[model samples]
Target: MTDPLVSLPAFREAAAERLGAFAHTTVPDSPGSRRAGVVLCVVEHEGVPSVILIKRAYRGRNAGQWGLPGGRMDEGETPEEAALRELREELGLAVGPAEVLGRLDDFPAASGFSITPVVAAPSDPGPLRPSPDEVHSVHHVSLARLAADDTPRWVPQIDGGHLLQMRLRPDWVVHAPTGAMLWQFREVVLLGREARVADFLQPDWTRN
Candidate 1:
C-alpha cells in the first residue's frame, strides 16, 4: 500500500530538516559569465498538493525536458528576486512576497551555474500565458500523482564521468535541477524518510 499524504505544515517541517543538513559542493564548471536562479512553485488545489513544472522551448541545452520556471539571475538581484521575476516573465503569474515559502538547497549545473530554487505559493490560480520564446507548456502535477505507481521512470547513467547519478521511482528521480529538491521534498516532507545524495547514483547526461 502507498503512504498517506502528509499535511502541508508537516511537509514544510520535514523539508527543513533535510535541507538544513545538506552540504554544498563546487560545480564542475565553476567560473562563468552568468548565474541563474529557479523557482519550484508548489501549490495546492482543493486540498491536493501539486508542483509547477514547465517545458522549455526546443533551444539551448536540456530543451524539451520538464523543469521548474526559472532562468539566469540578473545582476544585482537576490536569488529570491530572480525567482519571482522569472515566474512573471515566463508564466505571467504575479506572486506576492508573502507567498514565498522558503529556499531550497542550491544545485550547480555542468553548464557553469549554481541554481538556487525558491519555493513559493501562488497568490492567484488560473490560465497562464507562457512566454513562447522560452516556454513550450506548463503542467500542474499533484504530489499524489507524482507518487502514483505509473509515474515517469528515470534511467540512471552508467558512465563514470557523470557528476550526478539518479534512480527511477514512481514519484520522482534524483539528479541535478529539481532532483535534489524533489528527493528532499519526498524524504523529509512527504514520508519523513532520511535520504542523502550518495543514497542514489547520478544520471549520465548531467556530466555532459
Candidate 2:
C-alpha cells in the first residue's frame, strides 16, 4: 500500500508532537566553560524536508567547517533566545519564538563548551544573506540527502562511545558537536528512534 499524503502543516504538527514527547534539558554549564547555541532550521524546500547550515568563516577555531548557525549566547540569554538571535545575526533570517519546533539534548563540546541545539521550522525563509565575518556560505540540506546510505559512519573510539562521521560530500566531513547533533536529529526526528549522541567524540582537528 502507498503511504498517505501529508501536508506541510500536518508534518510540522506531527513533528512537534514527536519532539514534544521528550523532556529536553541543557547540560550544566561548567565553571569558566564557553556556552553556545545552534539552530536546526527545518524548512520545506520543493516538498522535501530540509535544514539550513552554514560554513564557518575561515579564521576561527572551527574555520572552514560546516556547522549550524549559532554563537555564544550573550550573558543572561536563554538558549532558545540565542538560537533565534544567531539566525538573524548570521543569516539575516528573522524567526519568532512560535516558529521553534523543539529542543534536542544538550551536547558538551570537547572545545570547552556546552552547546544546545534548537529546532525550528519557519513557513517561509525569505532571502538569505550570510554574514561574511561568521559564515562562508549557507547550505540547504535535505533530510533525504542526510539519510542516504553513504552519509554517516561510526568509527570506534578508545573510550566506549563511537565517533560519528557525517559526510556532506566526498571531500567534506562534519565533526562534532555538529555531527553528533545531526546524527541525533536524524535518528530522533527523522527515524523516530530514541537515539542519543552526547558522548560522541569530536574530530582531532576541532581541538584547537
Question: Which candidate leads in lDDT?
Answer: 2
Give the Cα-based TM-score of candidate 1 against the true structure.
0.70
lDDT of 1 by residue, 95-180 (tens): 76666666655665555567777767564744578998889887766666655444434454555333432234333343555565
The per-model lDDT (C-alpha) reads 0.61, 0.81
Best candidate per TM-score, number?
A: 2
- All predictions: root-mean-square deviation over Cα? 4.9, 2.5
Model 2, 46-75: lDDT tens digits are 676677888899987789888999989899
Models 1 onward score TM values of 0.70, 0.90
